[model samples]
Target chain A: MKISVQADAFDPGAELNAFSAGAAGAGAVVSFSGVVRDEGGRLSGISIEHYPAMTGKAIGAIAAEAVERWDLSDALVIHRHGDLAPGEVIMMVATAARHRAAAFAAAEFLMDYLKSRAPFWKKEYHADGAEWVAAKDSDEDALGRWAG
Target chain B: MKISVQADAFDPGAELNAFSAGAAGAGAVVSFSGVVRDEGGRLSGISIEHYPAMTGKAIGAIAAEAVERWDLSDALVIHRHGDLAPGEVIMMVATAARHRAAAFAAAEFLMDYLKSRAPFWKKEYHADGAEWVAAKDSDEDALGRWAG
Candidate 1:
């Protein structure tokens, strides 16, 4: 499994290629990407900021935990932190396994953890002004599904 | 999300970027790839062939089903219906969702349907000879998973 923090948009085909590069026995891989969107029928764009070292460390820890928890052959977590406009990418996760279930579980696991566990924060630039979006209680609720 | 059958390897990063292209509301997106493996300990290489029209139709049914089944914002499926080397890609599925679960579920569902329900046949080229591989009973069992 591999994890990274980058400043620019990544190429999904290339990233999938990289993860499949070492695949031999593996049959299935699962991945996810988070992107900035225009929401509320009004918000135009979003700008995000994160401490590079801390964000990378936190993502690494999350990936490590996933490796230990699942029978993954390969996995990746690439996150971007900086100013992003509507339709810009924020992050992505890819998981591979001998079977589809494990890949699915691990992919979902990393995404939920990244949302609730990562220290990186986001500030959306909207029509009114810049605002730091708080992590949702619903997001916490999303994590609940994993523990059980 | 977009799905296709190609003769070349795919880029996961690029597909993810495409899936998340216009959405700013999505906080997460998930994707999965299925690659040809020579590690069945049984094959020296892998080759795939399919009924082109049926393959596209079958995949479209699965992807459309996923959209109805999950809260997905976008989804794509690309598969190659020709010879592939070890470490070469066979197929890929990418998805975008508001959260991870839907993306994860839809991706998994798409994969399961592709493997067992889709209309494609894979032939393995081995040191001994070449033989077509049939979907295992286990693969169908895996399909029962989504049968609700």
Candidate 2:
């Protein structure tokens, strides 16, 4: 498993290709990417903040849990912080396994955690102003499904 | 939405990039890829045969169902037939939606259908001989999850 929290822009295509190449024994690969949405053009962009020291460790733990639970051959998580425009990829999670179900489930599990429990703080900037975006009940509910 | 049933090799990375570019206004994009696997080092490769006339139409219909059911912004399905070596990509499915849950569900639905119900027939080649690969009960069980 690999986890990265960086401010630099990344090419999902390139990253995905590299990840796939490294996962030699995996027959199934699943990837999920989160893009910034303009929301009817009212939003200009989004600004994300994170604790650099703790962010990678937190995400790594999440990825490790997913890898272990799913018996994944490999997994990757990449999150970008700072300003991001509409259509820009904010983060991505990928999982590789011997079967499609495990890969898909692991990727979704990572995404649910990222949306609800991860340490990233998000602020949406609009034409009028900017405001902090709170975690949605839906996100929390999604994460709850994995709980025992 | 786009669906292609081709015998030529494709770059999943390139297809994924193009699909993401076309799926604007989508907050979540999910992609799944199936690679040819050589189990126990006894396998050489695999040969896939498909009914060319009906393959595209069938997959397109499946993609349509997923788009409408998930309210997806866009969807893409690509399948390659003919002989494939280990580690080569055999098929891919991508779904774009306003939310991660919808995107993930739709992609998994497509994969389940492809594995069990698609028109493609697969034959696995080994050092001894070649054997036709039949659909597994697990694949049918996976598809059953989508039934109403």
Best by lDDT: 2
Question: Model 1's CAPRI class?
Answer: medium
RMSD of 1: 2.8
lDDT of prediction 1: 0.75
Q: Provide DockQ values for all models, in the order shown.
A: 0.62, 0.74
Off by over 4 Å in 2: none
Tell me the interface RMSD of every candidate, in Å. 2.6, 1.2
lDDT of 1 at B38: 62
Candidate 1 per-residue C-alpha lDDT over B19-119 given as tens digits, one digit per residue, 9 for 90 to 100: 66644566566667776666766666777777877877888889998988887777788888777877666777776677666777777788888888777
Best by DockQ: 2
Report lDDT (CA) for all predictions: 0.75, 0.89
Model 1 ranges off by over 4 Å: A51-53, B1-3, B6-16, B22-27, B40-42
